[model samples]
Target chain A: MHYTRDNMAGLLRSHDINPTHQRIEIAHALFSRQEHLSADQVMAIVNTRHSETSKATVYNTLKLFLEKGLVREVIVDPSKVFFDPNTSPHHHLYEVDSGKLSDIDAEHVVISGLPPLPAGMVTEGIDLIVRVRRTS
Target chain B: MHYTRDNMAGLLRSHDINPTHQRIEIAHALFSRQEHLSADQVMAIVNTRHSETSKATVYNTLKLFLEKGLVREVIVDPSKVFFDPNTSPHHHLYEVDSGKLSDIDAEHVVISGLPPLPAGMVTEGIDLIVRVRRTS
Candidate 1:
């Protein structure tokens, strides 16, 4: 379901963040946009409708979102970072030509199995980013 | 196998990289170490033994290693980049407490079938990284 205003409010409450108008708008932009975005890109979009939202605010809000586990950061390119709003376990195909990112559902690739962690080490979560180049 | 001089030479040759003495030594230091390292860390080790190896060489060699697909770069932590000598297709678990990384073989986690890529997009390799935090 689309992230309604109520949903954004609930998310802010759960994360202990104030559901300010700017925060809600930012969240709505992220949740509504299907494509991955960089912080600068998010800021650009937020500024289009709301001129009061500062770049620093956008960065801080994104950090808060990441801390609350509401967003995922993709590092397909070593130089730049992309943020994905979808929190579900999934992989990505990074288009080398366009620098566009698309999510791949977790159900698709057959993960053979992961080797056990070393002694005294604990397992956490997994990130799979598939980088794609144009073959044709 | 222990990454001896000969072993390093063989690895370089296998990857079509010219096995310079410096490259072999850097390879030895990288493969022999148990910890994941940044280019600076590799430089530290190489300079300790050979005063002639400059930072430029370390960066260049690391780039060569990465280009040849002999090493993997871990992006779990944004502060510093870590390089993995293990080139096998596997995931990683980042220890949030210690910032240590360990390889997870591809067999443990089952990555099933993947969703189709968007129209005009092609599938590429996948990157899986698991971050873990201790409850205590």
Candidate 2:
């Protein structure tokens, strides 16, 4: 999904977030590619266009996006966390060797025998990460 | 799986890890309870017996355990990493509110619709973590 500046602005606005220049740049970096990216990767892409955003801003913006439901976080690796632009209900295919991530259609995957929620606890969300490596 | 000191020693030997005092204590802390715990939690428990281990030791030992396949790392939270002693192929139920983690029998959970592996990529491992919160 290609996201123009206006489209990204509207997205942030709809999520009740101020469409600051930095936020817009971060959103563009994520929504434009429609792929999973880490904060460092996002910063790298954002800086590639000569638009400088502080590391603090990148992390804070990502956190804000997550809180506002504008993006999702994928936790497959211990060292780094991935941010997904597609906030819809979906899973991930993580290449362990290369540290690459791809989307998995949630509709296509089936889960069964999920035990009932423990007492007093509700189901918030489920993260299904399929870690894969090179066939060689 | 009850793990006594001897059992832990045997496990380390089987995995080619020298059964040092700290490693054995760490292993016992994990295998004895069979629950997902963070390094801090493990350290807290290990130090309870007055057998103190440095923070670096705890972190390093956990890393070593992960590499040796004696434990699994769960990265649901970016700030703190959880380690699971049950090295068997399985999934997890992560309580988002309390940070509680429980095991989901690998046999009970099933996954489908995995995409074709990228060229030259092999299947490493899959981590399915179901994040939940309290109902109240």
Best by DockQ: 2
- Residue-wise C-alpha lDDT for candidate 2, range B72-104, written one tens digit per residue: 888888888999888888888888877777888
* Alpha-carbon DockQ of candidate 1: 0.48
Show where candidate 2 strays beyond 4 Å. Answer: A48-52, B49-51
Cα deviation of A87 in candidate 2 (Å)? Answer: 1.5
Q: lDDT, candidate 2, residue A122?
A: 75
lDDT of 1 by residue, B19-84 (tens): 998999889888888568988888888888549688889988888898889887777776667888
Say what the RMSD of model 1 is. 3.3
Query: What is the per-residue lDDT of model 1 for residues A1-136, given as tens digits with 9 covering 90 to 100?
Result: 7678789888778878889988898888888776788888888888886486998899898888888888888776666678888888787777878887888777656666566555665555667777777768
Look at candidate 1 and tell me the lDDT of residue B76. Answer: 72
- Please identify model 1 stretches exceeding 4 Å from their true place: A1-11, A48-51, A107-112, A115-123, B49-51, B107-110, B117-123
Q: Candidate 2, after superposition: displacement of residue B67 in Å?
A: 2.4
Task: Enumerate the candidates' DockQ scores in order.
Answer: 0.48, 0.71
Query: Candidate 2's residue-wise lDDT over A90-110, tens digit each?
Result: 888887777778888887777
What CA root-mean-square deviation does each model show from the true structure? Answer: 3.3, 2.2
